[model samples]
Target: MSTRPNDTPQTLIDQVRDATASGRPLRIAGGDTKAFYGEPVAGDTLSTRSWSGIVNHEPSELVVTVRAGTPLEALEAALADKGQCLPFEPPRFGAASTIGGVIAAGLSGPARATAGGVRDYVLGAQFINGRGEWLSFGGQVMKNVAGYDISRALAGSMGTLGVITDVSLKVLPVAPAEATLVFRLGQHDALEQLHRWGGQPLPINASCWVKDATAPDAPELLFLRLRGAVAAVEAASERLMQETGGVRMDNAQAGPDWAACRDQTLPFFTPSSAELCLWRLSLPQTAPVIDLPYAQLIEWQGAQRWLWAPASAAMAIRSAAAAANGHATLFRAGADGAPGVTRFDRERSVITTITQRLRAELDPAGIFNPGRMG
Candidate 1:
């Protein structure tokens, strides 16, 4: 059982004050598994791993408050003991991934489309700002608020605004049952079917469509995961199989397959010799199959897509995604060191202004992980 040191908060405040006085940047870290995310940074490491533990848990109320540095796996296990879970299905890149990193990176798994994102689960947070002032926002229960919910806003901030100390999140019970199904279909048909199913009241929890160009003759595949009440899952599974001629994937295979897709451990994620960079595009779910210059694996019912392309194709790919009323992110750079590619989506002027204003107001000294999201 990890314990939050008796003076963790005050220690954090003192460290931030010293950093501010000396004008030195501080990089906030829990397990450090998500170092590759956001812009590369330089700063003195302010380790939060020791200030870790579940602060409070009320299973009846469906809320859990945990220190920022608590290992994500530990928290999940705790919730599992209660038969509840963080429905967003946050991905833990490494065994030591912490809750703080989850909120900062804001990466959710396949269930994100139907369940929710990190921000949606966030209920409250405690943090130390640039001036070494400790502050908190929101509460344990869910409710509608008139003003901005700073706790939720911190979800994807990448630690740029402040050093998060603790957070409270809403949780849900596990579904009573689950089923996985796979179908052989082309890109167009898969997209069409996914959109069609998205409109229905099915037990669909997640999906993924993959295309392998190397195996030209091999059939393209679409994988669907159904989860809910036992009756609902079985009914939906039978109906889907009947409609799409899909095979019911055995739990032995389905479990690992879904895990691989959620953690991005599939063969598609391996760097290809021809295309070295990885790109992630987020578009409307109803958008048609794009005519890009690279192969893609569509997820989130066509709302999220992943591709492998060389660095030189970044601009063209972004342009195509933009034309489709979406944005593309350079998820990974090439092994050979590619240039002129940015890692995140470019926000419009109004959104950018709001983001900047919030950052300035929260970290006025600009000492909290500078250039972290550049």
Candidate 2:
């Protein structure tokens, strides 16, 4: 069956209703960048490109609402104009990333440790559920809420739960000043420093790895940023230098470059045709198993890692990661290859059951994101 990217909300709903009743499963695709994120799928597809807009804006109230299909670039521009931004610093692959895509992926950057994840700032979302029935949850006002906080549940749910039409997000005023202090240390020292700062009453906005080609031993060059008043940043700078033995905060002339520290589309992303695959792993802060033929780059203060391994390395890597209390995802390479390794660290038995139940209620026909998530 063929479907046009319907423009109006009701039109989209009607389109989905008929499609679902016929036992048809709809695959919602946005921006098409994260297509490799979940299990591959071949089915009816609905594009949110037609349903785009910035429904509301209240600069004073620190919130903005937008259509699911609206590009994140547009949202950032709109917020910049208001001296405000998405405090969590969601990742954008390029110019075409959309708000809907951000929520679906449920990704957050370095600031996530300081502020919160993509779900925290979400005030509400409107979507057409798996059954093709229109469902609206949460709302625009900062504290306004739905019967259930289903709006946020939709964050990492991928599109398996619903087709997000529009969303209301809590925004933040841009920090008056920003700065970073780089610490060149090996794992033990780096983690120690990370912990030291973690215990301090300072402004450590972000931390990440900037792999240094010259030294594999010091593969991790940690970068930390500070936000807010110049004076506070200065004081934090002093405390940082004193604690880390003098690697002080410079102007961070390369602050923006550090922004790419998360969702880093490094050389890893290119040669887009490479049979190589990129996987995102979420694990416990301290996971002991560290066997890897692949290079490991981490963010979120080591809670999240991006592991690039051979397609065959999937299961071995996933097994190792699972033992360490984390999960791995086949997020890059095309799925045509027999996933030699586990595509995604299979969830725990408990989580597996819950996810199956939720999938049944959301995408009962298994129409949404077919194989990518589980």
Candidate 3:
């Protein structure tokens, strides 16, 4: 139960440098919203809330840079005004989930494919490395040099090697419109349909599950974001409607309704009654797929899926994904059941050693997010 304090980059670097130089550990906190995202960390926590605000915003350039501690909501509002947005949808559980948290967790919503993940848009970032040195990487532009893409690498690094202070990103102009098609079908059919559509060129931003108690297969919402002129959006929607067989156009012109789909907010959060444990699985695209025991839906089929499984079957779930060349992550874990594990796909020994060395070098005293990532 580490409390939080608002601290600036200089202060954080000083603290981290001192801690690393010595042997103290400092907890990293941003919006305290994504605490459940990974394994717990020990020691006192440092909050970025105080280091807030959009450091830079160029609407014309389509790049709005901001501090890591800036509120996701604030970014959204600002981008909304400019008709631009962070392509990868990061869940804003509350004001606590800051841009830093999104980067730390590498959490992106269903709009990930066409929209891209958090790492994809990261142009440049300023952070305090473990040596406690304030460092910067990337630029305000989309393309950058090769080598260690520091900015993007930090995207899913989970704040282990360093603490993010500010980030610059290539924002996407907000789409003129979006349409959601809610199709009620068998669990198996829903997945097949989404994959079928994925192969074809359709204006789809996100394809995922909508688990409602009333309708088991209740409604599978496929989001198709349309940009450019109004006619283009309408034309794409019509083309999509024609291609989609059993899918029903729940909303031809969805406004804010699409935002509601950004999270597994409630029902999915409660794991006890909900037998389907949340597992973020990435399976083989063409494997002989078995309809997961619990309700299942596909997002970039062959790429990823947000699934629910029984806690008792954790080993089985991991095995299935492993055999199929994918991995699974436990999103919601119950008190009694072992929540799903969070290690990303396995890394080679060389990669692992390199990572461990970096972690040690950055946090020699080994304090910030000690076990959270390694």
| Native-to-model Cα distance after best TM-score fit, residue 59 in candidate 3, in Å | 0.9
Worst 10 residues of 1 by lDDT: 1-10
Q: Model 2 over residues 256-341: C-alpha lDDT tens digits?
A: 56665655755434433456677777876544325675665666666667766667777777777777877777766644554555
Residue 4 alpha-carbon offset, candidate 3, angstroms: 24
RMSD to true structure for each model, in Å? 1.8, 4.2, 4.4
lDDT of 1 by residue, 287-333 (tens): 89889877789988888999989888888888889988999888777
lDDT of 3 by residue, 74-128 (tens): 8888898887888788878776678888887787876776677888888988888
Question: Regarding TM-score, does 1 or 3 come out ahead?
Answer: 1
Pairwise lDDT winner, candidates 1 and 3: 1
CA lDDT, candidate 1, residue 217: 82
Q: State candidate 2's TM-score.
A: 0.88
Q: How many pairs of residues collide in model 2?
A: 5
- The reply for model 1, stretches above 4 Å from the true place, is 1-8, 144-146
